[model samples]
Target: MGDKTDPNTTKIIHPVYIVANIQNKVRILDGKKVTYSSWVKLFKLHACGYKVLSHIDGTTPPAKTDEDYESWSEIDAIVLQWIYGTLSDDLLTRVLEPDSIAYEAWTRIQNIFLNNKGSRAADLEHEFNNLTLRAMPSLEDYC
Candidate 1:
């Protein structure tokens, strides 16, 4: 096996976001411009044989606070899970629909991960896992 950082070694090879549009039904731009739908199509085309544009949240969240109860670590783990899960082509795709700001935020996160390949992957992973477990005990199944 070659260096993990090697481009060839990367299993999911594609810029994290070909377009910033993450919301499912909403259009990112006005008119026939770059809507979320368009972005998904573009991403699919560029990703080629690689899987992308998988999960999309089909429903709205139950009433909850807008506050960011999650820490940076938790956010990181969720991002990794989203990417890895999406690559597997098994996770429920409807959970990622483009109308949600949470999805947009997730796209930003994936971009950060792609830009910071040299960063401490293990530390981020640990922090994310811990934070997730603390927030939802049920998540222990995945952790």
Candidate 2:
């Protein structure tokens, strides 16, 4: 019988690698809707829940010589698939690229939303209109 302490036979597993039902948990991210931030928030939360946040947190990959590189890349690809599955056809086409890892894909999607001046302006306006004089420490601070 094989012993439990055999490192060669042991395969370390992560939650993200286990396929789960995501129909209700992850909805399509509509770039045209006000739900952009909401969609991104939920996506990040999903990744966080499975402890694969690092794959999508914009961190550089480990060197090929590093012992963790292979495992890191495996998880990165899984995370990348998660990102791809949630995007709509239009967004998927826009963000998809050959051999892109999770971090690269995350940055692409983030830049697309963050650089939207219209959405940014609207969010700013909404916040500004609701700002109170007492919201800040002082009148000058509020202004």
**Candidate 1 deviant stretches above 4 angstroms:** 1-113, 120-123, 128-134, 137-143
Please write out the lDDT profile of model 2 over residues 69-137, one tens digit for every residue.
998989888888888888888889989999888889889988887788798889989999999998889
Put down candidate 1 lDDT per residue, 1-143, tens digits, no spaces. 75557556646424433324323322232213543345445434533322333322223333345353333233333433433333312222423444344345446534443455556567668867677555665775646
Q: How many residue pairs clash (N, CA or C atoms closer than 3 angstroms) in each of the candidate models, in the order given?
A: 14, 0
**TM-score of candidate 1 to 2 decimals:** 0.20
Positional deviation of residue 125's Cα in model 1 after best superposition, in angstroms: 1.9
The per-model lDDT (C-alpha) reads 0.40, 0.82
- Where is model 2 more than 4 Å wrong at Cα? 1-12, 32-34, 119-143
Displacement of the residue 101 alpha carbon in candidate 1, Å: 27
Top candidate, metric TM-score: 2
